[model samples]
Target: MDYTIEIATTDFITTESAVKGGADRIELCSAISEGGLTPSMGHIRKCREMFDLPIFPIIRPRSGDFLYTDEEFDLMMSDVKLCKELGCNGVVIGFLLNDGMIDKVRIETVVRAAYPMEVTFHRAFDRCKDPFIALEELIEAGCQRILTSGQQIKATDGLDLIKQLIEAAGDRIIIMPGSGLNPANIKYVAEATGAREFHGALRSSAESKMEFMLPSFAAIGDYINPAIKENDVREFKKALML
Candidate 1:
């Protein structure tokens, strides 16, 4: 199975380390603690200079709801275009219908904006009302890949369903299993589902980038909570080695 790491933050130094540690590709974003948001142009540009691996950016504008207004849709399109200009290999994005189906019109609009670059339908797939029905919409929309958790919390817990999706998708689109994937469980997920790709933050909660030294500082300083940790990747890979 192919191992993929997602660096959902603006830290270039840590992002580079992920590239060096045998990562096949990266999904770039920010604020993973809030389930990720679209990263800045400067962060994307910096990572582009640091790594030649495929850097597929997460095109989520905010973390809350997937249903977006026309204006929000416009913003997503603009960001998709920017990612293409910044040399991203592909983009990870998704939009859902009010009834929890794939929003075909919006899908076409973003896929069209991405143009020559690939589009990965992200975890929003798990939210769909029916996996089988959603599969048709994703394929019809010309999505290159779909990152799903087998409609569960992790691939291991949903391995049987994941296998079914993999078989059903066939060669039409990639079924990349994401969410709660770590080194220890990668082998089982790969074996059970025959999935070729995995996605994880590889986070180990390393010390905060900033610390609060004062007692009166009730605001609890340190704006960035997701400190970058290389060991998370290292240990993850090590577990996979077994």
Candidate 2:
């Protein structure tokens, strides 16, 4: 019953708000709308200065698939080193083969580079051909946790498999359900999966305060920036309490 909620934060504002609203930890990233990419070094440093909670920055080099080229893999290792230099508590990472299996060699190398810091294999596990086999591979690679939606688009839709994964994981690894969680279904997920950790964004949008709205021009890709609302984070935590 003593579960923890980790907020997926994109910037300093969301980081502060999530901590204020009682987020136990933070998964810092950029471009969350595109499934989260590695955040800037300045963002990681600023968050370390601003909060006392554990920070785990995503180590993905790009937005598309978990498969990476040798150069991309090198960039990811450098990012992991940078996260450690910034005093981040951990890093979230995942890599796969073209055949849809865990990239064991590359993953082990990355985890070794991360060193004493905790590492959670990200949703790339969902892309694997077999969840059970990938689960064992992650454990062998020394990951502390796996953030997954049971290989489905949403965790709720994969509740049965999530429960099975939790049961299979036992004390060997932590299985944290993420993707598409909200206040309404968090309780159900907790009860059904018996998981001790959960991850969510709990984000809402607010329009920019620019006086002159560009009727014909779009400066940024998005009109309304997505941010983590304190109330929504609080509500998600409250649901876990219940």
Candidate 3:
């Protein structure tokens, strides 16, 4: 395929919906509000049964940052083993130093643990104090692909850096664009970065059963401007067609 549409989804329902709406791959996981975390074995199994597309689980142990402790690294290793056993197509992970650099040691440990399956470095690369330095480390660490927003608040905002990264990658690694990708600009982002892959979450919050219980609902970025908009999967696909 010339274009790959990657949709980040938490539950099986979301995964199924994405595939039906034309997503090519699914980054299977849960607790997306906290970024993402490893999906349960049951969730992975359900997704594997439900869709033919590749499912890559997010192996992040916590949400606040990309920095991980020794305990967290061990947890990630264990998580990768379980993900492989459950037949996940790949695993997405990243680890960083306190000063915002790739933790090559931890990444190596994970790559070793996830043997035979593909590995993707997640947005943690965006947090790296230095993208160029981190990209080299990831290449050395043997990560096959990286999902980044060009280290900007939005992918569009970082178009220039993304272009440079794409040129620098030069087929040695995949530079998947994610974060702030929407139908309105996906085509533009792809053209600018020369990336074949795209990643985003297509979601809509209907009235939650417990809306009035205490909290109404959680929005991905702006809580105060909580306006419900259905996930824009089809729009993205349509843009890709043009």
Query: lDDT for each of the candidates?
Result: 0.79, 0.91, 0.82
**Rank ordering of all candidates by TM-score, starting from the highest:** 2, 1, 3
Better of 2 and 3 by TM-score: 2
Would you list the clashing residue pairs of candidate 2? none
Index of the highest-TM-score prediction: 2
Instruction: State the lDDT of candidate 1 residue by residue for 1-242, as single tens digits.
Output: 33454444445666776776666678888877777789888999888888888998889989876898999989999999999999898999999978988888999888878978899999888888899888888888888998988888776777887899999999998898888877778767777888877787776444454555454553564443444466666665666556
- Quote each prediction's TM-score: 0.89, 0.96, 0.89
TM-score of 3: 0.89
Q: Which wins on TM-score, candidate 1 or candidate 3?
A: 1
lDDT of model number 1:
0.79
Per-candidate clash tally:
0, 0, 1
Residues 1-242 of candidate 2: C-alpha lDDT, one tens digit per residue: 58889999888888888999999999998988889999999999999988998999999988999989989988889999999888899999999999999999998998888988899999999889999999999999999999999889999998888899899989999999999999999999999989989999887777876777776654563467677889898999899888
The candidate that wins on lDDT is 2
lDDT of 3 by residue, 113-144 (tens): 78778899998998888898888888888888
